[model samples]
Each structure stands twice: as C-alpha cells, then as structure tokens.
Target: MINVVIADDQTLVRAGFRSILDGEEDISVVAEAADGAEAVERAASERPDVVLMDIRMPGVDGLEATRRIAADPRLGDVRVVILTTFDLDEYVYSALRAGASGFLVKDTEPMELIHAVRVAARGDSLLAPAVTRRLIAEFVDRIKEPPPAPRLNSLTEREREVLAGVAAGLSNEELAERLVVSIATAKTHVSRVLTKLGARDRAQLVVIAYESGTVRPGWLS
Candidate 1:
C-alpha cells in the first residue's frame, strides 16, 4: 500500500480527505497534522510515500514546510503534493520550486485525488493543462516576454526528446512505449533531464519547457 500523510488545518477537511483516501485499498492515510510544523514532524516520523500538504497553515505555511521537506536528506523520497483553494499562479510557482510533486485544488474529485496520490508516490508530478497554463502565466505576466532559453545542451538529443515528452504530459510508461524502450530506460532519461536542468521536480521541468520555449504553451494537450 502507498503510505500517505494528510496535512490540513481544518478538522472537517481532514476528515473528508481521510474518508476518501481510507477507502482506497492500495493506499492508506498513515498520519494527519493540523498545521505545517506538525505536518513536518509527522512526515519525519512516519516517512510516508506521499504528503497531501495544505497551504496557509498556522506557524509555518505549507510552502515553507514543503521547502523544508524537500531539503531533508532523509525525506528525499517523500513526494509532497500541495493542496490549495485555487490554482493561484504564485502558489503554483512557489510550490514547484519548493519541490512539490503537484499543486491540487482542495475540492478535487475523489478519484482524481486518489490518482494524484499514486502519481506522486511514484516520484512524479500531476498537473492538468489548465493548471500548468496558470503556472506559466505567472512568469509570463511578470516578465511580459520569454526569458532567454535555458542552456540544456548538456543533454543528448534523445534526452531532450524525452524531456519534451514529459513536458507534453506523457508518463514514463507512456514515453517508453512511444520511444520503444524499456520503462527503466525511460525513467533514467527523465532523471538525467531533471539533474542536468538543475530541476528538483517534473513540475519545474514543465514550467521551464514552456517558459523557455522548448515546449510551447498548452502543448501538453
């Protein structure tokens, strides 16, 4: 089973999420925290596979908690998925930069929430096309023009292709099938792309791809 931790300040919200996730046979809500600091502590203690972290908690906010978790050497394998009220641009950018696996709206459908948990547990991201556009718009709205393209030439042509696929919202399994390679090989390519790009997560890669013009806006559809 995929171990999960639910971190939300609202008691009712936590209860709702627990009710939804607890029913999943492949996953379990191993712990719950009412604030960011508690969330961090619980995460350190439980070492869950995924953390459903809510933003705007008292004391340390979820963004800071996410940053702290990402920086932890012991919790490197734990995937953080930020749960917020809306797809606010700043929150999206900050969450991705803070090493979160995804930004999710709190009212997300039950099945989608379950799927997101599974995706994050596997060390990947989950972003709908609309949400990704909102994220890119944060940079676009601030700069008014594209930043100079990031130098990703350290990657071979194949690796770049793989990155493009990832930016297009293809999973590693889908990419392997498309590229006619083993799933393990596809995963390696993704790892190399993230490392060479100095990206902490795939959500950032998608942002870079669009913001850098390597992948056009809304290309994932």
Candidate 2:
C-alpha cells in the first residue's frame, strides 16, 4: 500500500484529502498535520511513502519541512508532493529546489492528486508540459542561474539528451520515441543521468538541466 501523510493548516483540506485517499484500496492516509513542523515530525515518525505538503504553513512552512525531510537520510524513501493554492513561479521553483517530487495546485482534481502521489512514490516527477514551460519562463534569466554542478560533467552525450528530454517534461515512453530507441534504453539513460547528476529524481534533473544550460525557455515546446 502507498502510505501518505497530508499536511495543511486548514482542517477542511486535510479532511477532504483523507476522504479521497481513504477510498482507494491501494493507498492509505497514515497521518495528518496542521503545520510544517508537525508535518516534518509526522513524516519522520510515520515514515509515509508520500507527503502532501502545503507550500504555506505556520512555523517552518512546507518548503523548509520538505528540505528537512529530503535531507534526512532516514527519510530517504519519502517523497514530498507540494500542495499549494498559488501557482506562482517562485513557489514552483522553490518547492522543487527544496526537494519536492511534485507540485499540485490546491484545486487539483481528486484523481490527479491521487495519481500524483503514485507517481512520486515510484520516484518519477509529476511534470506537465504547461508546468515545464512556466517553470522555464520564470528562470529564463540564465545569467543569474545557479552555479554549475560539477556532477553534470559526468553525464554522457546520450544521458545529456535524456536530461533535456526530462526537463521538457517527456515521459520515458515519449523520450524513447523521440530518440528512436527502445523504452528500456530510454529508462536506462534516465537512470544514468540521475545518478551522474546526483539528482534525487526527475524534478531535480529538470532543475539541473535548466541551470546547466542544457535546456532553456526558448527551447521549450
């Protein structure tokens, strides 16, 4: 079963999420928290497979809580899906940088939210094409981009291609078709790229692909 923790300051939101998730046979709502600090604590204690974290919360806030959880070796199996009412670029960028595996607008459809948790649990990012375009637009000022990660140098040419495809929000199947290779080859390239770049998942790979100049706003579809 996919264990989940819902963290939001609003009581109604927590109840709503729990209600939706509890109906799924393969998923379980293991815990709920009203604040970021509590969310972090619950995550550490419950060790849920996925955390639906609110971007804005009292005390530490979701960004910091995500950072703490992501940084903890003990919680390495945990994946955080940032839940927020705002679709601001800053929030999207910050959440990913803070180690969020995915981001969802608070009003996301119930099924989408459920699917997001499953995607994150499988170590895949929930990136949509529109989301990728907006993300790249927000960081187009490449001059002020983050410092280059040395690990980026470790990627082979094919891996770099895979990284760019990932930043473009292509799934493994799409990537395979684009490269004219088998899906297994595409998956292998993605795995190698993640390892070489030291990225936790495709979300971080997207970040590095942009920051390293492998992908750009103008190039996005």
Candidate 3:
C-alpha cells in the first residue's frame, strides 16, 4: 500500500484530501497534521511514502517541514508534495528546493490527485511539462548567475542532452521522440543522468538543471 500523510492547516482541507485519497484501495491516509511541525513529527513516526503538504501552515510551514524531512536520513524515502492554491505560488520553488517532490493545486481533480499520490509513491515527480517549464523559468530568471554544477562534467554529451530535456519538462516518451530513440533508451539515459547527479528524483534534477545553468530560462521556448 502507498501510505500518505495529509498536512494542511485547515481542517476541512485535510478532511477533503483524506476523503479523496482514502477512496483509493492502494492508498491509505496514515496520518493527518494541521501544521508543519506536526507534519514533520508524523513523517518521522509514520514514515509515509508521500506527504501532501500545504505551503502555508501555522508554525514551521510546509517548506521548512519538507526541508526537515529531506534532511533526515531516516526519512529519506519520504516524498513531500506541496499543496497550494495557485500553480505559480511564489513559495513553490522554495519548497522544491527544500526537497519537496512536487506541488498540487488545492483544486486539482480527484483523479489527478490520486494519480499524483501514486506517482510520488513510485518515487517519480509530478511535474507537468508546461507548468514545470513556466515555473522553473520564472525562478531561474531571478538568478543573475547560477552557481556552476561541477558534477555535470561527469555526464556524457548524451546525458547532458537528457538532463536538458528533463529540465525542459519532457516525459520519457517525448524525450525518445525528440532524440529519435526508443522510449527504453530514453529511460536509460535519464537513469544514467540521475545516477551521476545523485538526484533523488526528476524534481531535484530540474532544480539542479536550473541552478547549475545547464538549462536556462526561455532556452526551451
């Protein structure tokens, strides 16, 4: 089963998510927290596979909670997915940097929400291509000079292309089409890039791509 923890300050919000997620046979809402501190505590104790976290909470807030969870070696398997009212919420990038696997809008369709939980449970990021490009580009624009990514030097030319494609928000299938290779080959390339970068998932890879200047804002556009 895919264990999940719903963390939102509002009671109704948590209940709503629990209701939607509990309906899934493969998913279980193991715990619920009304604030970030409680969320972190629950994460440390429950060790849920996925955390549906709200950005704005009474105390430690989702970003800090995600950072705490990401920093904890014991919770390495835990993935935090931020819940926000807006897709482009200013704090979303910060949350991602703090090790959140992804973000979901509060009004996301029930089916999409379920799918996101499943994706996170499978250790994949829930970054839709168009939204990811726009979001990452917006944040990258503010960085006058991104720090160099020395680790990128270890990647092969093809691996670099795969990284760029990932930062551009291309799925494996799309990447295969773009590179004129089989989908399995595209997956292999992405896996190699991830291994080299030591990224936890594609979401962190996107952050590394932007922060390291491997893929710049508007370059894909």
Candidate 4:
C-alpha cells in the first residue's frame, strides 16, 4: 500500500483527502496533522510514502517542515507534496527547493489528488507543463548566476538533452516523442541522468538543471 499523511490546518480538508485517498485500494491514509510540526512528527513515526503538506501552518509551517523532513536521513524515502490555494503560490518554488516532490492546488480534482500520491510514491514529480511555465515565469529572474556544476560534464549529449527536458517538466512519454525515441529508451536516459547526478527524482533534476545552467528561463520557449 502507498501510505500517506495529510497535513493541513483545516479539519475538513484533511477529512476530504482522507476519504478520497482511502477509497483507493492501493492507498491508505495513515495519519493526519493540523500543522507542520505535527506533520513532521507523524512522518518520522509512520514513515509514510508521501506527505500531503499545506504551505501555511500555525507553527513550523510546511516549508520548514518539508526542509526538516528532507534533511532527515531516516525520512529519506518520504516525499512531501505541498498543498496550496493557488497554483502559482509564491512559496511553491521554495517548497520544491525544500525537497518537496511537487505541489497540488487545494481544489485539485479527486482523481488528480490520487494520481499525485501515486506519482510521488513512485519517486516522480507532479510538475505539469503549464504549472512549470508559470513557476518559471514567476521566479526565473530571481535566479542570479547559477552555481557551478562540475559534474555536468559527466553527462553525454543525449543525457544532457534528457536533463533539459526534465527541467522543462516533460514526462517520459513526452520526452520520448520529442527525442524521437521509444518511451522505454527515454526512461533509460532519464534514469541515467538521475544516477549520474545523484538526484533523488525529477524534482531534484529540475533544480539541478536550473542551478547548473543546463537550462535557462526562456529555453523552454
């Protein structure tokens, strides 16, 4: 089963998510928290596969909680997905940087919520193309000179392309179509890139691509 912890300040929000997720045979709502601190505590104890975290909480807040969870070696397998009222929330990017696998809008469809949990459990991100474009537009300018990535030279030409596609938030199938390769081949390339870079998942790949200057703001256009 894909165990999950729902961390939102609203009781009804938690109940709604729990109801939708628990309805799935493959998923289980293991725990719920009304704030970030409790969320982190529950995560550490339950070690769920995913945490549906809210960005704004009373105390530690989702951003800090996410950072704490990400930093904890014991919780390495835990993936945090931020919940926000707006898709373009200012803190979403920061949450991603804090090691969240992705973000879901509060009003996301029930099916989408289920999909997001499944995706994160399998160590993938939920960076939709439109959301990615908006995220880039909103924060690209804030990225000053990217830090050096000495390991970037380790990538082959094709791997470089894969990394760029990931930075642009392309799914494996989409990437395969763009590269004119089979989906399996695209998956292999992405796996190779992740392995070479020691990235946890596609989310980290996005961060690495941007920070390494392999992909720039307008490159997706």
| Candidate that would win on TM-score | 2
Off by over 4 Å in 2: 140-149
Model 1, stretches more than 4 Å misplaced? 145-151, 177-184, 216-221
Q: Model 3 compared with the native: what TM-score?
A: 0.93
Candidate 3 deviant stretches above 4 angstroms: none
Report the lDDT tens digits of candidate 2 across residue range 111-188.
988898898888888886476457655765545665666777888887888998998889999999999999999999
Q: Tens-digit lDDT track for model 3 on 53-157?
A: 999999789889989999998998999999999888879998888888888889989999999999889888887647866887898889999887789999999
Q: How many clashing residue pairs, candidate 3?
A: 0
Q: What TM-score against the true fold does each predicted structure earn?
A: 0.86, 0.94, 0.93, 0.90
**CA lDDT, every model vs. true structure:** 0.83, 0.86, 0.90, 0.89
Q: Name the better of 1 and 4 by TM-score.
A: 4
Give the clashing residue pairs of candidate 1, or none: none
Candidate 4 has an lDDT of 0.89
User: How many pairs of residues collide in model 2?
Assistant: 0
Candidate 2 displacement at residue 159 in angstroms = 0.8
Candidate 1's displacement at residue 207, Å, is 2.6
Tens digits of lDDT, candidate 1, 118-175: 9889877885556665566555456546678657768798987887887777888889
